[model samples]
Target: MKIQEIREIIKLIDQSTLTEFSYESEGTKIKLKKYESSSIFTNGQQLDSSSVVEQPKVAEVKAALAPVVQQQKEVVTETVEVAEESKLHKIKSPMVGTFYQSSSPSEAAYVQVGSKVTGESIVCIVEAMKLFNEIEAEIDGEIVEILVKDGQLVEYGQPLFLVREN
Candidate 1:
């Protein structure tokens, strides 16, 4: 399924009162669950409904019912420095797909470290099922780091870049 279709499902679930929702179609299964925060008050009092806050977690989307191939690859660890600025932000993936740094293989990357961007700027593309979906920064900032490499497989809500607010 396309990212747009998955987004629509998420939107519908957000508008409903259901705590859990799942959909299966054409060998793909998507499930969404809402997590409500629980807090304890002073004097050992129970928390009331007014204190509850509900947050919808990212919907998990799986490709095929049957899983087959597995490949083993080398692993490496790298340390990244995070900005001390409180306005630092992350641009997260809206769907699971293969991340591309540029529109095509031979072109320069859309954004790199120190690149300034606006909320509507297209930072990268996540290609799923042969459909390339452009991902926006969504926040005005200067790109501090690129989180994903070219052709990397990313999951829903995965951070693609670290940006410091302008």
Candidate 2:
């Protein structure tokens, strides 16, 4: 690439908060970093043709990397919920999947916060491997809170709902 194009690219990276960027074409490769003013550039040497065609989405890869960094310290998370002491218990996911409130797009939710439920009541569904597992309320209660949002990826044993027993 020409000098003006590279300046434009660097300006673009600097203007935006992109932490890193790279480009390669015609046997030349260049990498840029926004952490500091200086960027590491490797030139003249030819990059393997395979590297140019299969450019990975840096945003997606770095998006998942945040958790690893947080895990290295301790579990750091913003609290979206709280628990209350009562003759009640929380309904939890048994497996990992996207949690859904309704069976289909147009269907009413099986249960909601403030909804009364029985021991056998279908409170929610966990969609794992294309199969929707109906999650039942283990204890008869009135739902005090709904934990996970619809269509959110839920981990095994994650709190799905909190209920206050009747």
Candidate 3:
């Protein structure tokens, strides 16, 4: 299926009340899901449901690292190096999908290791339900690692890239 057609389908889904949608054609299967999370309030003020809130990448990454850190601390104990770790952040997949490193097969990979990226930079594409959603860096950083290979399947919240904050 063409990307354009898939985009249209995604548009339709977004405009409806459906939480999940799937399509299959010629041995290609696509699935899309909407993640509905509860509302968050600050200072007793309710934020609009339609607003897009950009969560801090570092905080999310740190939360994900908690278990790993505990394991390492237990393993090393007194000899554990308390040195400052690199301030690297991760660009995570927003949805479950097949990840494409570039817009097309013939195109060069978007952001590779050592590539500098800003919050607006497009690092890769995640195709969910045939819709090619451009995944952005969403943080100012230098790409330190590309965690997912081209065309690899990625889960929601999975780290796609490790970027050192600039």
Quickly count the clashes in candidate 3.
0
37-151: candidate 3 lDDT, tens digit per residue: 5674668987766674443343443454355456555756644432222346878999999999999999998888999999999999999998999998999989988888898
Q: Of the candidates shown, which would achieve the greatest lDDT relative to the real structure?
A: 3
The candidate, 1 or 3, that scores higher on lDDT is 3
lDDT of 2 by residue, 1-166 (tens): 4576567566555545467877654455769885533333348655553333243354644453444445433522322122134335979899999999999979999998799999999998999999989999989889988988999999999989989988
Which runs of model 1 end up more than 4 angstroms from their true locations?
1-87
lDDT of each: 0.74, 0.74, 0.76
Q: What are the clashing pairs of model 3?
A: none
lDDT of 1 by residue, 1-166 (tens): 5686668667656644567877664466889996544654658888865654453344322222112111111111111222253346989999999999999999999999999999999999999999999999999989998988999999999998989898
Q: In order, how many clashes per candidate?
A: 0, 0, 0
**How do all models score by TM-score?**
0.49, 0.49, 0.50
Off by over 4 Å in 3: 1-86
Better of 2 and 3 by TM-score: 3
